[model samples]
Target: MSKALSKRFGEESMDRIITWLEMQKISKDVALLDIGTGNGVFLIELAKSGFTNLTGIDNSSTAVELAKAIAEKEEVMSLKLQVADFLHPFPKLSQYDICIDKGTFDAISLSPDHPAEKRSLYQQSLHSVLKEGGMFLITSCNWTKEELVNHFSEGFEMLQELPTPKFQFGGKIGNSVTALVFRRK
Candidate 1:
């Protein structure tokens, strides 16, 4: 099955994402990376919003295939998809203007019932790919907005917290959710 990552965060999240991207000051040609991207929802969405330069990475074989098919079917010419685990060591990145995650790190932040592990995992996994001053936006149900700010504060500057769209669950269900937008320092 394909991963649609229905964690809620939706269209209302775009203005926040786009605004954060602008503050990062990534050039028009800068590379945009979506880590733990499942089925390429944001990649396709961003492309339609005028961001043609993007790449999405997922650990699932099926996800990469689905994302590819979706990209092709959607006529998204610039989005690239690959398979890779976030926990494993990845080759160094020399470039990238932004990195976005829809809780891939949060998913890994589990410890057989331990919840705090996700914070550490998220910090390290994101460290490798995020360029100096690159932007980061993460959406999670595990931590409150304030907690997220403190967690990423070590390497990122708390830029802004857009009211993440609602979900059917805790916040708002089915409202195309909301996420914490940040800039790497």
Candidate 2:
């Protein structure tokens, strides 16, 4: 599944993210956090793009270990991978300059019970970890741009909508994947 997703969304999705980062003119010294850093692919891409201050976290121990190994293999000296649950706030750490989510919310929302219970928690945690005016980027297959904007309406201003590959859907431009960036207020 990881390999398949990497092949499908790796280049195009990452290019969109890179473009957003460039537009923001985020310096290499600014802290970055990657929620649900599965296999650390996105962080690796950012690292390759000259992002120096990078950190990633996931609840899965296996994933954290894999991400650590991959980071080492890719020689990302400044990247840190840790095992963490995003639903809980991190009191020991400071706010980040940027926080990114790629399919993390989709996985959390897939829970059979109390799916939305954690959504609020995650939002609160994001608020806690992200500095004022900091950016949050999210990419998902489960939500449309409007849905995502509505979901994070409070304390955020929608900034940019990344382009997605549209297919013929009732004579409209429809896509399976959507990406958006928002700034905290």
Candidate 3:
């Protein structure tokens, strides 16, 4: 059986993003990203939809390698998984057409104190990767959509705020979970 994640990080959140991806006329050539990409499961789904320009980045080496293995075993060609820390300096900007951050900002926001750094890192990392006029989807529960917009909207414009995503608990399968969505403008 596959492992499970907490209710906050469950499939409901992914399904929300998939809806956004579907709304996009995802072609075989547009770049797609899954930042804080744990195991690259989200990228796998996007790849399944014929988005060939899929790239995934994670902070853990083991996770990156494991995601690569899983992608290989599944024969997925629309992916390039990497081990990268968003806290550090990043490369050139205007790279990808769309950036999907499943929960990277949420994890950073969960840290004790340091809202300034949390917001800054979110902006810089996102800035360095996304192309002008590209789409960025930030999924989180650590902050409400309004909070996320207020804190990180200095560089990014507010495009759209989708409804909150919900899921069942990992331990208690009957309970439900909710998460917010922010789209980059």
Q: Which candidate number would show the highest lDDT if scored against the true structure?
A: 2
The models' CA-based lDDT, in order, is 0.71, 0.86, 0.71
Candidate 1 residue lDDT tens string, 27-111: 6566888887788877888787677678888889899999999989998878878888766646843367788877675677644
- RMSD (CA, angstroms), candidate 3: 4.9
What are the per-residue Cα lDDT tens digits for candidate 3 across 76-158? 96588888877674673247878877667777877788957876876887777777777777766556656766876666776
Assess the local accuracy of residue 134 in candidate 2 as a C-alpha lDDT between 0 and 100.
92
lDDT per residue as tens, model 2, 1-185:
47886567756777888887887787977899999988898898899988988889999999989988888888886788888889885674458989999888988888887988888777888889999999999988888999989989998999988888777778787887899999999
lDDT of 2 at 18: 84
Write the number of the candidate with greater lDDT, choosing between 1 and 2: 2
In candidate 3, stretches whose alpha carbon ends up further than 4 angstroms from where it belongs are 1-8, 92-94, 113-115, 165-185
TM-score leader: 2
TM-score of 2: 0.93
* C-alpha lDDT (0 to 100) for residue 183 of candidate 1: 77
The clash tally of candidate 1 reads 14
What shift in Å separates residue 124 of candidate 2 from its native position after superposition? 0.9
